[model samples]
Target: MSIKTQKIFEAEFLLEDMREIIRKTSPHSAFSKDDKIQFNEKLKKLSEIVEELRTNKYTELKIKYITNGIELRTREEDFINIHPIQAAGRLTLEARKALISYGDGYSTCDWCRKPFRLDKIHRPPIDEFHSELAEFVGMDQARVVPGARRGFQAVVSSLIEKGDSVLLSAISHYTEFLAVEDSGGTVKEIPLNEKNIVTADATVQKIEDVKKNTKKLPKLIMLDHFDYMFGNEHDVYGIAKVANEYDIPFLYNGAYTVGIMPVDGKKIGADFVVGSGHKSMASVAPSGVLATTDEWASKVFRTTQMVGDITGRKFGIKEVEMLGCTLMGGTLISMMASFPKVVERTKHWDDEVKKSNQFLDEFLAVEGSKVISEYPRKHTLTKVNTTESFDKIAKTHKRRGFFLSDELRKRGIVGEFAGSTRTWKLNTYGRTWDQIKYLGHAFIDIAEKYDVPVKANKQGQYSGDV
Candidate 1:
């Protein structure tokens, strides 16, 4: 068959179109001759990479590890893997194809030719998509951001000032601390209860403590729906209510909740809601959505009316925090393509939770293993302490902690942090019942092989050995 008849012909056409657009839009006077030549060389390299992807030239680089999709690496598996991080945002086949098709240039912006305004008349669908996204999270307005951290940054920069105090969970993600610090605000952590869960009472106490210590009410209260370290669910509803009582603006960090579970920002009493597209929205990396209620929309999404000081050029656009246009190209397109599936999957979040609990039960059945997260997990990400069971083997084993990793790998298991025999986390978010059962059995079998006593929990029956 001729080259035109090949599957890559469409990719070739798209690349050529992109090249033509770049050439036509290029302001030759803005760049020196050498700079233009270098730019052209980079474009050529990009074109070659696209061609290689179109022809499936990278198949040889595939890894065979069965991690259940925990880490952010692609695999050639036919079925879904039982990974915590990978399960929620795992790209659909359709999303992958969409990424390739729209990967050539800033396709969305290039086609729409609009900046700052998400709801432009020329880009009706983009505007509609923004509306749908806002509605999805039960917020009044929303904008695509580079990531969830950027969402936090935008809100903090707009609302916080130097020496302003912000409230966060004791187990809040590092990004939250960085966002507040970058905005010149001080962070006060709400201590966790013995259950490893952040309670509303603790939040209230922390808020009052901050007021007393700093002699000022906290400017913002940010809490995660589900913490990353332990995957434990926090009492965001209660915390939000507390924020309202104090008249403090609340920002809901839904990095682990938004796309994977049902979240209503207004119902939760949040002024702002942040979601990670790459973490839970089934999109590529560095993509996220920042949403806000109407009460805070004017401040967070304020438009720019600045004029160039030197040339007196008026640039009417959106806020500088958003940096004008946000996500474009493959990231936005893939998110759009995966929206329907994500919507449907979130409706069945109960099933995912049930599976997670079941897997945890079997893992706990092995004597000396205990789950560190709250019992009857509300989220799929879990922290466990297996020092009694697994670490016991690591004490004298020749390979030490690595032996467990080697054994798990032999059983077609991956995603667990290597050399971690004592305390570690795993996500059983999207595993099939069979896979979950097998995973549970794999741990028990490995323990038994190591001569660790295995006593299955049987109703009221007590094993004094354990």
Candidate 2:
């Protein structure tokens, strides 16, 4: 059972990715064949060890297809990765340890009983975890979806009818648009304010305008607590109020807020809450949660009344929106494993923001660099303008925009877009203070090396003025 395994979970995942990379190349090429053979050899060795463990394992083993960041690892152990989306999603040691036990197919369903639904599974305490997750975000009920996008799909498909209108932020994620489209609904954008932030006033005007033109209220109102583009907090509480006033249900998109920071769905007057486990919670890819208030839980999570035409059977307990159970694979298990740590991390969010602000404070010391995100950093994700700073160097450098990525990689900092210089985003979530400090110094050091002017630095202070 509990075999003392090495940290091979990540190493083996990387090996699988390596195989995939070679598969996409010229298969007939000798080089490709050679690389594939080498990968297969190592994989076989890993498989042998896994087989030994599995024969004796009643509990833990070192075998699982962990599809987290397989395509691009950036070696978090060796490099400081500020990749905007992945900074928080990196799995905890416990989550990896969990993979040893539940990484097999449908591992979480071994004790499925009664209604035979995922949320009803009580052996691993999954049913209770669902309840805890609901309360974690201040909602009455919760279900894990494949991703935050799927969470949007569940809400839209549950409510939206053909030709119905939905309200969304002008800078809404593309997946939101797709979710509405799948439900045969048209979405009208609520334009951002001068500060590039979505406001309740704008949402109100958009709803009224849609109502006047279409002669009916929109089916749903969806807004991000923090938009992905600018990582700027929107007027979500205000929008919730507007939605209530307009007699419309509001879905709070918490892809950026939920796991990293405390999200009170009831307090925000949210009819539904959607969060990304792979984006904020320290979990595997394609995992998230959709929570709803008691008022909307019945409708959104409505069970199927479909009967088997040939078998003459009914599946009344199965949720139509979820198609019974949403996440039943390793993705769900990983989310379960990371839940406790994720809950505790939310409390330290203020400290994370402080680290973010501190890093930005020094980053701005590079004369031309600017922070495009909201000042003083409410959250760890941010958009920075390096056009006037790094872009200047990129224009004259031989490697062009790649010069930045290349240099940062040399300094053990990674996750920036190669050949990108103008405007880009990064996250400082879950990084240690020392790592954050080194990140700041790395940028400042690079700037000074490039002959960029430096401003006088007052360290450890929030310098929002760039």
Candidate 3:
């Protein structure tokens, strides 16, 4: 197809939509007794304005903006700022600062993390580095907005236009698939290798085969830095290099590995990257980050709304001196503040978790279960896939992760189920080896209760996505 499509994907979270649904179906939170007077007053004012906006008969009201000795009148009574760019430039700085300071640059779990406050009265050090961090995960560098609605949609739409040939994993994140489909990209899944890893070679070979057989070079290369379902690590940097060699732009998503994995965009040499703030960064919910090369950053800036107002803007020295105020920004500030600590603590914990995984791997091997990816190079969120004959395998630890997750919560352990899918990704950080050991044993007990086969030695059979 010679059709050049706009490949943008936008993901939006439906909080306001949910709120409206709740309002119509369950209006309990609509207005309390305290808000009754204010609500009525607002409603009365709205009615009066609506009445004033409507004139008798078909008469029209004109609103005119006078500029350069010319009166531009609008019969439809719509108003727009003549200097939107100027207003945007002025507002962007303050908004950015507020966004940065709201979370006080840190994130702790609801149970174990701490909340930091940046007061409007005191200024923080200006030179602190808050980098956009990620690993070789797959995602395009679109803008990240507050929720799944406006921001994600914009990103998805930009990349996946109708009839474009795209490749993805069958067991990938469903939201990503939806985004691609919405953008009209035709998805083709590359089957898992025998070892189940999405090796760079495997992906490249698939592209070559597709080209040779179907006479088409893939327009876009898509894959995650870390496979979400199988706990497999694709060599993202390797793939990017290959794609670069082949003249294809790589869209990398660093969802599972962003915060936890140490990835450098420049070192990796990828074209576009997107990540989640809540995943690894201690950012608050509804925050995310997208990074690209300076050249692409300009292109994305053109397609995106370049709002200067973020939680990271600063005021004039006179304003700062008079108000004596600073801080007061977005949750990203907390993520920024807490990121180094979180990364440090998580790294230390990750080493321990790897040690634990080895122990479990050996124990399961004795029980006739297979452990995939022996001596895994990085940390992972586990996924267990067995033959169709082993349908009962899911039930073995189906509730174990949840039970352990709740138990950890009790013990102030704060790992999240990365997304709402069946994949229960555990955070190795924020807990001790003793906890993981206990949880491992608990999983064994659950497996036994389900009558799953286990060997007496349980040596090497620990196959899972981590």
Best by TM-score: 2
lDDT tens digits, residue span 1-466, model 2: 0133333444455465555656567565345567777667767766665665567543344443334644433267657889899988999878887875677778888899889899999988899989999999999999998899999999999899999999999999999999999999998999988888998889889988998999999989999999899899999999999999989999999999888999999999999999999998888888999999888888889998878889989975999988888887678878888889999999998999999998898888888898998897888889999999999999999999999999898887888877899999998999888888888888878887899987877554323211
- As a whole number from 0 to 100, the lDDT of residue 278 in candidate 3 is 54
lDDT of candidates 1 onward, in order: 0.81, 0.86, 0.47
Model with the higher TM-score, candidate 2 or 3:
2
Give lDDT for model 1.
0.81
Instruction: Tell me which of candidates 1 and 2 scores higher on TM-score.
Output: 2
Q: Tell me the lDDT of model 3 at 75.
A: 12
Superposed model 2: Cα runs more than 4 Å off: 1-74, 459-466
List, in order, the clash count of every candidate structure. 2, 0, 89
lDDT of 1 by residue, 1-466 (tens): 1232232443444466556555665765455676567657656755765766677563122233325865423332433344557667778777887886688667776546545464452442677788899999999999999889999999999999999999988888899999999989999999999878888899889888988888999999999999988898889899999999999999999999989899999999999999999989989888899999888888888878788899998757766778777887788888888998889989999999999998888788778999888888898998899999999889999999999888887776777878989998888876787787778778777877889876665563222211
> Clashes in candidate 3: how many?
89
